[model samples]
Target chain A: MVSILGVGLGVAALLVVQTVMNGFGEEHRLRIRESFGDCVVIAKSPIEGPDVLIARLKADPEVISASAYTEGPALARRGAFSGVAFVRGTDPLATDQPVRQYVVAGSFDGLDDGRVILGIGLARTLRVAVGDKIEVWSPVMAEQAEKGKAPLPASLEVCAIVRTGFTEVDDRAAIIPLRRFRELWSLGERAHGVTLRLKDPANAVATAARLNVGKAGLNFIPWQEIKKNFLEAIRFEKTMLFFLMFIITLVASFSIGSTLFSAVIRRTREVGVLVALGAQRWHLVGLFGVQGLLIGALGTALGFLLTWGILYFREGILDLINSLFGNGDMVANVYQFSKVPLHYDAMDFVVAAAFTLIVTTVAGLVPALWAAGRKPSEAMRDA
Target chain B: MPKVVLQATGLKKSFASPNGPLAVLRAVDLVVHAGESISIRGSSGSGKTTLLQLLGGLETPEGGEVFINQVEQGLVTPRKLLGHGVGFVFQNYQLMPELTALENVVLAAKIIGRSQVEGKARELLQLVGLGDRLRHLPSQLSGGECQRVAIARALINEPAVILADEPTGNLDETTGKEVMKLLLEVVAQRQTALVLVTHSREFAEKASRRLVLAGGVLSSA
Candidate 1:
C-alpha cells in the first residue's frame, strides 16, 4: 500500500502540475493571439504610402484580417484626475471589434465619432466614465499641439471601457480611432505598422519572417518574438517541472523496488517450491513484472482519479489556499492570471501511465531476477 | 512385470567442505519401473535427499545424468521434466503460500499449458480428502493437510514417476502412516513408479524394494 501510494502521489503531482502549467502557457498564447493578431509587420517609421501595401497584405489568403495601427505615450486628464497610458490607435473596424468583445461598460458603437475606448485599469486610474470627455497630451504630437500648428483632436469622448482579463495589458492601453492617430501625428493615409491576423496563429513566426513588408520600408515582428521571453520562461519551467516530477517518480519506484525485494526474501521458500514444481526462470521474471505493472497501473489509475477530484474543485482549492495563507493576489501574481486552468489531455495520461509502468516494472525486475538467479536447493534450504 | 519408467546412472554430487570437497553421492544409481514402489533409507547427510533431488531434476549432479520416460528423446530440463511425467513431494509441504490448495495443484497442469485443469485440481484435492478446503490457502492448512495438498499437486500431471523426499518427515507417526498408505494406494492405482526417501525402516519395509544409502553408494537392503 505504501508503494502504491508513493507512486500515486507522484503521478497525481505530475498530472496536476503539468496540466496547470500547460494551462498557463495556452492561456497566455490565446491572449497574445487575441490582442496582437497573429503577427505584426513593424516599421521603424510610419509608411508614407501604405494603401498599396495594406491591399497586398489583405490579398494573402493566410491573412484573416489586417489593420493599420499606431501606439505612443499619452497623458489623459479629467478634472483633477490625471494618468499616463499607452494610446493605441487602430482602424475603427480593425481594433473596434476586439474592444467591443471585451468591453465591460458602454459600447464601441460611437468610437469613430471622435470617441475613445479605455482599458478598465486605465479608466480607473484616470477616474473617468463613459460619455466623459478627456483631454489628451501626446508625446509624439506634443510640439504640434503646443504651437497650435496641427489641428489635433484635443478632447476625445470615452465611448467604452474594456477589461481584457489580462491586467497587465488592461492597466496601460487606451484605444482610439486610427484616423485620429494619423491627424494628430501629422501623417496622411499612412500607418506606422500593420497587424495581420493569420488563420493559424503559430504560423505567425514563418509568415512574418517571410512576408515582403519591406516594399513599404516596413520591418517585421512576429508575436512569438514579441512574447518570446515570457513564453520561453513558461516552457523552461514546464520542462524543469517535468524533470523534477520524474525524479519524484523515480524515488517512488525505489520504494516499489524495496517492497518487491522484501517480498522476494519473504517468499524464498515459496519461490523454491515454484521452481521445483516446474516454473522456469523466465516465468518468475514475468510473474514479478506483472505484479509490478499491476501496482503501477493501479496507482496511475488512482492518480488519474485524484487529478479529476483536484480539477473538479480546483477553484475552491485555490480559494482555500489563498484564504488560509492570506496572500493577496498570490495566485494572480505567480501565474499571471487570477484563475487556475485544468487542461485535460489524454496524451499526458498515456505518457505518464507508460512511464510509471516502465519504471515500476524495472523496479520489480531486480528482485525477480534475484529470485530466478537463486538455485532452488539454496532457497529451499534457507527455509 | 512393469517396465522401467525412471533411471539415474553414476549420479555423482558433492559440496565444498572447509577441509576438502565433501563427496555426498560419489556414485549413485537407481531404477524404478512402472507401478513399482522403491524406498531408499539413509542416515542424515547420507545424500538420500540429494539423490532424490537429482532424480527429480531439482538439482544437477556434478557428474552423470537423470533420464525419465526413456522411450522419448533428448536430455531432460527441470522445466520439461515436470510435464514429461515427473513429480515431486517435499517433506516441508512446500505449497505456494500465495495460492489456495486447489491453485497449488492446478499449477502443475498450467505449467504444461493444459486448460480445463480446475476440474483436475478438484479431483486431486478430493482424492487427498481436502475437497471442502479447495479455496483454503496453504497457511490455513495443517502440516499433514499441506503435505496432502503437495501430494495432490505432484499427481496433477499423472506423472510416470513421483519422487518423494522424506514426504512424512514433517508429520507425526500416525499421520505419516496414514499419508504413506494413501500415497502407495494412489501410486498403485495410477501404475506410476514411486521413489520414496525416508529415515524410517518401517516405511522402507512397506515398499516392494528397499535400499540403504551409505558412503555415497546405494546397496540392496
Candidate 2:
C-alpha cells in the first residue's frame, strides 16, 4: 500500500505539472492567434490591387479567410490624455476577421469610415469609451505640420473595445476603416498587406513557405516566426519538466523494488516449498511481476483520479495557495492569465502511465530473479 | 514386481565451510516402489534432508543421477520432475501465508498445469480432516491444522511420490503422532511412494524400510 501511494503521488505530480504547462502554452497560442492571423503577406511598398491578392489567397484550400489591411504608428489624443498606438485599418465589411472575436465592449460591426475600435489598454490610457471621439495623427501628418503645411487630425468615434489578453496588442492598438485610412495616408486603392487565417494554424509556416515561392515583392510571415523564441522556450521548458518530474516515479519504482526484495527474503522457505512442489523459475518470477503490475495499475488509476480532482478544484486550490502566500493575483500579474489554465491531452496521460508501469515491473523483476535463482535446499536450510 | 516410483544412485553433495569443503552426502543410493514407505533417520547436521532433496530432484547431486517415474532428473528439466513426479512436505508446514487452506492445496494442482481441481482439492482437505478450516489462512490455523493443510497440498496433484522432510518437527507429540498416522494412511490409500526424513526412532520403526544417515552415508537401521 505504501508503494502504491508513492507511485500515485509521483504520477499525480507529473501529470499536474505537464497539464498546467500545456494549458499555459495553449492559452498563449490562442491569444497570439486572436491578435494576429496565421500569417501576413507584406510588400515593400503599398500593394496595388490588394483585392485581387486577397481573392487569390482565399482561393487556396488551406486559407480560411483573407483581408487587406493598412497599418502604421500614430498618436492618439482625447481631451488631456495622449498615447502612442499602432493604428491598423481593415475592411469594415469583412466578417471573418480574427480580432472580431475579442470585441468586449461594443460590436465590431459599428466600425465604419467615421468610427474606430480601440484596444482595452489604449482606451484606458486615453480615458475614452464607446461614443467618445479621439483625434489620430499619422507620422506623415505630423511631418506636414512641422513644415507648416498643417493638415487637420482625423477625428473618429470609438465604436468598440477589444481585449485580446495579450499586453503587446492590447496596450497599443487602434483599428479604423480601410477607406478612412486611405484618405488619412493619401493612398488610393492600395493596402500595406493582406492578413490570412488558415484552416490549420499549425501548418502556418509551411503555408507561408509555399506562398512565398516565386511571389515577387511580397514576404509572407507566419505567426510562429513572429514569436519563435517564446514558443520554443515554452516547449523546451515542458520537456525539461517532464524529465524532472519523472524522477519521482523512478524513485517510487525503487521503493517497489525494495519492498519485493524484503518479501523474497521473508518468504525464502515458501519459495523452496513451491519449487519443491514443481513450480518453475519462471513461475516465481511471474508471481512477483504480477504483484508489481498490480501496484502500478492501481497507483496509475489513483493518480488519474487525483489529476481530475485537482483540475476540477483548480480555482479553489489556487485561491487557497494565494491566501496562504499573500500573492492573490500572482498568476494574472506574471503570466497574464486570470486563472490557472488546465489542458487535458490524452497522450500525456498515456505516456506517464506506460512509463510508470514499465519502471515498476522492471523493478519487481530484479527481486524476482533473485528469488528464482535460489537453490531449494539452500533456501529451506537458510530459512 | 512392484513398480519403482523413485530411485537415486551414487548421489553426492557438499557445502563450503570456513575450514574446508564439508561433504554432506558422499554416495547416497535409494530405491522405493509404489505404496512403499521409507523413513530416513539422522542426527543433527547429518545429510538426511540433503538425501531426500537429492532423490526428489530439489538439489542437484554433484555425482550420479535421480530417476522419477523412469525419467532421469538431469536429463529432463527439474520442473517436469517436481511438477508431475513428486510432492514435498516441509518441516515448517510451508503453506503460503497469504492463501487460504483450500487455495494452498489447489496451488499444487495449478503448478502442475491442472486446473478445475477445486473439487479434488476439497476432497483432499476433507480427507486430511481440514474440511471446516479450508477458508482459514496459514496464520489463522494451528500447527497441527497447518501440517494437515500441507499434507493435503502434497496429495493434490497425486504425484508418484511424496517427499516429507520432518513434517511434524514443529508440532507437539500428540499432534505429530496423529499427522504421521494420517500421512501414512493417505500415502498407502493412493499407492504413492513415501520418503520421510525424521529424527524420531518411533516414526522410523513404523516405515516398511528404515535407514540411518551418518558420516555422509546411509545404512539399514
Candidate 3:
C-alpha cells in the first residue's frame, strides 16, 4: 500500500500538471488565432488591387476567409484624456466573424456606419464611456498641421471595447471603418496587409511554407511566428516540469528497491536452505526477480488507475474545491479563464505508464541480481 | 568395499582473518559407505562446520576435492552436489519463514522434479511426529518442530548421505535427544549414509565409527 501510494501520487501529479499546462497553452493559442487569424500575408509595398488578392487568397480550399486591413499610428484624445493607439482600419461591413468574436462589449453592427471600437485597456486610459466621441490625430497629417495647413482631424463615437486578455493588443489598439479611414487620411484603396483564416489553425505553418509570397512582393507570416517566444517558453517549461516531477517517481521507486533488498537480507537463511536442497543460482535469481516484478506491477497498476480516476473527475473535483472555498475566483483571478480547463491526451497517459513501469522494473532487477550472485555458504555460516 | 557414497580427499580450507590467513582444515580425508553412520567430534571453532561445508560442496576446499558415488565434484555447484546425492541439515533449522511445515518439507522434492511427491513429504513429516503441524509456518512452530521439518526436507530427495551439522545444537537437551533419535531411526530405516558433526559424547557414541577432529586432523576417538 505504501508503494502504491508512492507511484500513484507521482502519476497523478504529472497528469494533472500536464493537463493544466496544456489547457493554458490551448487557451492562449485559440485567443491569438481568433484575434489575428491563422495566418497573415503582408506586402513589402502597398499592392494596387487588394480586393483581387483577397479573392484569390480565399479561393484556396484551406483558406476559410480573407480580409484586407489598414493600420497606422494615431494620437488619440478624449476630452482631457490622451494616449497613443494604433488605429486599425478594417472593413467592418464585411461580416468578418474571426475578428468580431473577440469583441468584449458593444457591436460592429453600427461601427462601419458611424462608430469606432477601442481596446478595453485603451478605453480605460482614454476615460471615454461607450457611445462617447474620441478625436484621433494622425502623425503623418500632424506635420502638415505644424506648417500652417488645415489638418485632417478625425472624430468617431465608441461602438465596442475588445478585451482580448492579450495585454499587447488590449493596451494600445483601436478599430474604425475603412471608409472613414480613407476619408480622414486621404488614402485611396491602400491596405497594409491581409489576414487569412484557415480551416485548421494548426496548419498555418505548413500553408505559409507552400505560399509563394515573394512573387507578390508579400511576406507570409504564420500565427506561430507571431507568438513563437511565448509558446516555446511553455513548451520548454512543460519539458522541464516532466523531468522535475519525475523525481518524485524516482524517489518512490527507490523505496521499492530498498524494501526488496531488505527482504533479500531477511530471507538469507531460507535461500541457503533452498540452495542446499539443490536449487540452482538461476532458481534464486528467478525467485527474487519474480517477487520484485509482482510488487512493481502492483504499484504501477494502482498508480495508473488512481491517475485516471483523478483526471476523469477533475472538473467536478475543482467545483467541489471551489464550493469549499466559497468562490469561483480560482479560474478567473489566477488563470484568467472562465472555468478550470483540463486536456486529457491519451499519449500523455501512455508516456506516464511506460516511464513508471520501466523505472520500477529496473529498480527491482538490481537487488535481485545481487541476491542471485551471493554464495549459499554465506547464509549457512550466518545461520 | 560396500560402495562408498561420500569421499573427501586431502581437503584444505582457510579463512582470511584480520591478523593473517587462518587454516581451518589441513589435508583431511574420509569415506562413508552406503547406509553407514560416521561421527566427527570437534571443540569450538575447531573447523567441524568448515569440513562439513567442504564435503557438501557448499564451499570449495583450498586444496583437493570431494566425490559422491565416485563422481568428482568439479566446479561444485548446488545442482551437481545435490544431483550426486548429498543433503544438508543446518544447525539453525533453516526453514523458510513464509512457508508452512509441509511446503518446507516439499521444497527439495519440488526442486528435484518430483513435485507430485507431496504425499511422500507428508509421510516423512508424519514420521518425524509433525503430522498436525504440517500447516504451521516456521515462525509458529517450536524449535524442535522446525528441526523435524528440516529432517523431513532432507530425506524428501532420498539422498544417499545426510550431512547433519549440529542438527540438535540449538535445541534443549530433551528436545535434542528426541530429534537425534528420530534422525537415526529414519536414516537407518531408509538405509541412507549419515555423517553427523556434534559436540555431545553420548550423541557421538551412537555412530558406528567415531572420530575426533583435533588440531586440524581427524583421529580415532
Name the top TM-score candidate.
3
lDDT tens readout by residue for model 2, B151-208: 9998887778899999889999999999999999999999988999998999988899
Query: Residue-wise lDDT of candidate 1 within B133-197, one digit each (tens)?
Result: 99999889988899999889889988888989999999999999989998998888888889999
lDDT of 2 by residue, A66-112 (tens): 98899988999998999998999888888777788778898899899
Task: List the TM values for chain B, per candidate.
Answer: 0.94, 0.95, 0.93
Scored against the native two-chain complex, candidate 1 gets a DockQ of 0.51
> Which DockQ value does candidate 2 get?
0.71
| DockQ comparisons of all candidates to the true complex | 0.51, 0.71, 0.58
Best of the candidates, lDDT: 2
- State, as a TM-score between 0 and 1, how close model 2 is to the true structure: 0.87
Name every residue pair that clashes in candidate 1. none
Q: How many Å off is the CA of A227 in candidate 1?
A: 1.8
Tens-digit lDDT track of model 3 for A288-328: 77766666677767766776787688778888998999887
